[model samples]
Target: MSVDTIYKVILYPFITESIASLKAMTNLQGTAGDPFIDNVDDFRFKGYAVCSDVTGNLDGVIMMHHYPETAIAIGNSVCEKMFDEKYEHTEITEELSNALAEWGNTIVGRSTDLHGRYSLEYNFSSPYFVHDVSDMAKYLAGVTEVVTVPITVEGVGRYYFNLLVRSVDYQQVGIKREESRGIENTHTTTLETSSKILLVDDSAMIRKALKRYLAQLGYHNVIEADDGASAVTMVASESPDFMFMDVVMGEVNGDEALRQIRAAGSNVPIVMLSSVTDKVLVDKCKDLGISGFIFKPIQADSGAEIIKDYLKIA
Candidate 1:
């Protein structure tokens, strides 16, 4: 479909009075010292997949992909703004997951209504989450073409709204055909690197993206921890030179994990990564003596510079 049409379909559902109000409040809050605000608008897609099938005239699937953290963040934002309930952290509780799934369903249902303007009738399946992209691929097996629209939910992060259509001609949908290009070979020298870094987060996408970014910057000795508890254990066993930790995580959070590590007297320099910017939490992290704090959807070059500077990796 035309990019404009795709964009319209993707964002049409969220322009309602209730959601628009929330968006306004979120933008007004900004990334200031508010604890609820984290790195919610990072331009990276590091999360899980929520998909719903659209039948009838539009025979395709609409998928909303978000990082686990991003999903929780969005859910919490919705709860607080729409339901007048406050969630301290964006942990994936059952209630939160259900809320998110329902939100997805609503969006899909509403967007399908727009199809009627084209004299097309559409129906959608219940939304479901998939932990991995590969698992999501199974559902898209017969899809001939796909259109992806990226949108940022204030205080939630970036999300990909994808539509997979079956037996659709690309030209009819305004997609152009282009010749595939081969990879180019270029000689490069590896910079001397020695930091053993640990990346801790629940999102596999974040871990992989950060790991790949670090690798490209010549920081190859990287380790990963999926949660705060595992991060604590890895700290003791791995003895990493530096750590990048997500603040809102399962088991022990970044702050508590840092507390445990400090209580044991291991002064490993750690940088906190988060989408939330709660002042209380930031002060608590400062008290725990964090080396630095980096927002999520980390930029490779700048992040590499921060690491090198902190580790003195000249």
Candidate 2:
């Protein structure tokens, strides 16, 4: 891998509600950490490392390293978003650890998929979390080059992403020239000026980003809802032509919201948004009558296409 590819993967999955809030604070305080910089020699022992093996055309191990405080902060934030509960740093229970590990797996697995699309077939092992950095260093003893991307979460310190992989020829792997262009620009589609759209998510950053994206695509009458219960109310009152809902939220999740909406006999087109892949939940959504699924962090171009295709917009 390329540094840009790694950065794109990390940006989408890790930048949750709490992380986005921290990033905004860092921007205002002028204490933001450096963007993904390579510094393998200065790697010091200070945090938790979630390690996973990568196998295929490019063989190596991927590690997500976060300072203990950062890990605890992220874990607590995730718990609050998912379960509507607060957890202190001292309450680092197995439940929190498992949640963190699952998060790690989702990020690594999605990164692997990005690599695979470039013809670099890769598979990741189950994530293993360790509190000591020495264990992570030992695992990468023989690896020569490692790519480190440092992310600064305001309340917590900096978190790092380390990738240790064997060298490979990008051209030989069949990566296309256009595929390396990173994220594509959003495509504008013609739609009725009166068309209404509803965005449902707990994260302010995500909701804002989606609204901006919709504005770019010529859809301005967009309404926002913070959680599932609120989303249900918006669907009834706003009567939007389309809705994009986040799967994970406090109180009522996206699934239950859809259930309630359908139970009330509303036939508005709905798309489910999520960062993780869960077949059972996806099948359940289909049963609940969701029109489509969009994975987070939503790409402008792809998201616009989903709206155009699913809603039959010109």
Candidate 3:
């Protein structure tokens, strides 16, 4: 859909009712130009996705956040809320939480489509519930930049239609960079765990780019080892948090390095990162217990996500 065509208001009543309740505002029957919305005074609803910069402040920890995957999952759930099971909810919080996490996973993937202006890079961290719309700006006080897209599910049926980015930036996200662009200058998540990252790759270019990306993801400590043998040494001595292994190298390929590491009793997540898409070679790594596999030319955001999700970092 055109960015201008996407607004903040749903044609369906069921969706509108929930949006009103979620925002704790008066009952809204928003159909056309700006229906009821939560968070900011300027934000209204169209179909899905809520996009606005109501306060005219676009710096520090922009919350381009989406958790509507919960709405989709819960919509299909076989509960009183879903299929009308017996006794209908003394509690449904656990299911809702799981639904929310799944929503984050799917929405993050869908966002890759709109990452033209800025890289939407982040893991699903503990969310701060802000009831008051005025306090949303306060909730995202520190950090840099705030972009919020409300992925709204409109209509009720066997399968609801999803609008992942109901509203995106009306204007281009101000971006200027040396390399490939389309990313906010600053987005730092609070990393609760302190684990060392060992990046194993022969290419200097890949290593440098990855190291910078890790730092951008708020991973302060990352150690880079050039070859598989050194990486194996780090596995034993450094006891690193995780390893990113490049598949092909002059002396030893990733396959050899992986088997050696596994033999050494290091169960740390080992992700085989390679440009080689050959099906047979890829399968071999799978047999050796590679924690994750990502192709070469990995985007900074995508790489960080594989790491966070596979490791379940808090």
Candidate 4:
């Protein structure tokens, strides 16, 4: 994806929310610099980078690169806000790493809410801290794209917010330049309420969220499965017109369940949902012939659009 496409579709929402989050949590006024393509092959970490792996509608890693002083300042600020504690350290300490990782989780987790507003879908991993390494490129092995935006935190110095993508299709993910221009003008295609939709996930919260979103989109004939094994049984019995399933689950993971369903001769439009973008898992799902894929922390509007695409509105 181009830098602009990446910015508008993904980074913009993240950076906007991130800056706001930084202000609220650390009470630090921050500004985002213009985003630019970074040379991944020759990239170097300034001191340390806190990284989160992202997958689904998009697949990549996001890094918050910081200098020693910047990391210390931000880490201390976060700790003070969270635990009323501050750190005194010349180098990265375990406590500092824990604080940064927790802050990173808070920032990325909050960003998903805003992503829904933009009809975007993607999943993010828990943040982990990485120190400056001699082989930076090797550490980021599969990343094909990189975009960097500098965040200038008042008095704390500047830290870089970087997006690194393994692979992504802007158009397929509904963020193409031409289409993005008219996104606001697009209208929702309402599907008939008679259609049965299967919602499968171990989390009642997720099932509840999807039920609400489906209700808004005029699909009320919904079925629920708490796990993948149950999902297979429900498909045979309910014969749902559309289905949404989480990839990772207990008893039977989604991929195995999908394989069983396919083996039993069912071709229902099943969309796989997950926060993981592991190539092996994605490729396995594709080979099993999934109808579509959605990144976790699903948004109502974005999920509705995907459902519409698969089960065309009547």
Candidate 5:
């Protein structure tokens, strides 16, 4: 059977971006096994899970299930990255819970960005944690199908992304659903479309999504690099007119790469992309002279406006 469009466009992309986000946040390599489909009743929780309710174009539950050790390990990694802490955790703590929750939020939030592009906007409630989940029948009351993808992070162990799919409740979402494109569907731009653009991010899925947005705005001369080091090299070799760089990357981060590019005397209009909201980090990026900022789960309209302003497309 053909996969549902929701899975093909939103859920599947969510799974891919989840792995990318995991690696970006923790500097750990993550790999995904084939996705398994089953009834919601078959949902298995190892020792811990974080779950959030998704609403809007699609409504259902989305979760990340992990063994206790896996949660502790990954949470510690996030702590080290965010706070520069060296202490390791053997049990779940308030700090660790927050880190895992934020991580879950990032994965779901980025997936929703793809929703807007496909005209399937969605919003997710804040995630909550569960220990040794034995029953989810309440949450799965009306849900029928569950798609679980197993993701492993080598020494850190494995976790699963489980999506409980359900049809949207028109009354609850408070809007009539329509198949046709409305006024917001138009993504046309009067700006020149021939600018050679560079997209730098470790996630192939994220690059592909952004490329689609750029294409919709008439930009096609695009090149991609999966990490900051390659981005630095491509900036010299490709000489793109504009660039979009991710903040957290392997090798060199967006800020350091920006410093290198400027040091090389290249004044390309570069916009920084990230989900991080740390003011200090944002200020540091400004100090490095970013052309603009596009928060993660990037909005197409906002990105378009930033590009137009930087390119002076009047």
Candidate 6:
């Protein structure tokens, strides 16, 4: 709830990466530019990264805005750094956008760790590219303060990574985040929990990612079913110990699938995985008897731990 909470979680990562990029491009060990508190005065992005909408209420809705030229540039730069040239941004704006997006995400994770005990969590938005800063600034209606992290990219020029923090008391917000506590056997409990797994998804890409993430965590026995109908079938047949069920699909979606599973007398742990987290959708999920849920782009270790908890792994 404290204003300093945001800084404690995110500031170090943002500042370090931005400064390193500036140093590489400028070949200078000093600061790039003054880390200013921008009043949302016209910003721009250059290379390749596109902004995505994360979550939370900034005007009761959350989104990431990138000034076109600047964003693209940030994107390209970030692409180069995070991956190979194949992922490099074609435009400078994209480079900037990607760089900043990566930066923001990293900071969000860091902040999550810091404020976890306080019950504060950040739901990041997708980085979206826009050429007009004024238009984007309109969305910052409820944002009390935004810190523009200044960095001197070695030779590429001076750019910024922004932390749009809207403060609220940790106790005042109503949101559910998994408990961040763990015992010394954290790593062991994660890998040994190879219980029944249900894969309910219409998209192969998403399913692929989930499967890969799980496999990497050493959960090799997996079951994949495309729609709600098939998901029910899998639940009965596989009797999976746990599942990664998506919310939207062609014939039947997550809600119906979950309802069907419950109706069929299945109590296997199921995590509602989806790209969107709308109130109506969540209500439906709650109605279906699903106690666990995870959003799209699952993070490392989380799925494994959730599965363990649901399956009661030793």
TM-score per model over all chains: 0.42, 0.47, 0.38, 0.51, 0.52, 0.42
Those runs of model 2 whose alpha carbons end farther than 4 Å from true positions after fitting are: 1-41, 171-314
Give one digit per residue, the lDDT tens place, for model 2 in 240-299. 887889877767989999999999999886878775445567779888877667654443
Please identify model 4 stretches exceeding 4 Å from their true place.
83-87, 116-122, 132-135, 172-314
User: lDDT by residue for model 5 over 1-314, one digit each (tens)?
Assistant: 22344455445766777787776667577898877786566665677787778887667888778888988998888656544346499998877776776576667555544444444456666456677455665667787677777898988889888777786532111112122111121223343688798999865645765786677677899999988888889999999888889877657888888888888988877777776444566678777766666665433334444445444321
Candidate 1 per-residue lDDT over residues 103-181, each given as its tens digit? 5544443343333334434556645677654565466667665665555565555666566666322212222111111
lDDT, residue 206, candidate 1: 53
Per-residue lDDT tens digits of candidate 3, residues 172-199? 3433211221111121343344668889
RMSD of 1: 19.6
* Candidate 5 deviant stretches above 4 angstroms: 1-6, 121-123, 131-135, 168-314
Give the best candidate by TM-score. Answer: 5
lDDT of 5 at 101: 65
**Candidate 6 total steric clashes:** 71
lDDT of each: 0.57, 0.61, 0.44, 0.70, 0.68, 0.50
On residues 1-314, what C-alpha lDDT tens digit does candidate 4 reach at each position? 67877877777756776686576556478999999988878777787887767777788888878888988888777655543345466666766665665456546644543454344456666556678477466556888778999999998799988888888754423322110101121224433688898999865656766787677678899999989999999998889887888876768989999999999999876777765444467679888977666654343335455545555322
Better of 3 and 6 by lDDT: 6
What TM value does model 4 have? 0.51
| TM-score of candidate 6 relative to the true fold | 0.42
Error of 3 at 152 (Å): 43
> How many pairs collide in each candidate, listed in order?
10, 0, 25, 0, 0, 71
Question: Which candidate model has the greater TM-score, 2 or 5?
Answer: 5
Give a tens-digit lDDT track for model 6, residues 1-314: 34344334444433453344333321234253434454644433332222333244221222233334544455454444333243435454433443454444433333333333343444444334445545655546566656555554344444455655555332343222232221112222332445657778865544654676666567788889989899898777777877778776668878888888898888765667654445466668776766455543343335445444433323
lDDT of 5 at 143: 77
Summing lDDT over every window of 10 consecutive residues in candidate 2, give the lowest-scoring window.
176-185
Q: Give the Å shift of residue 221 in candidate 5.
A: 46
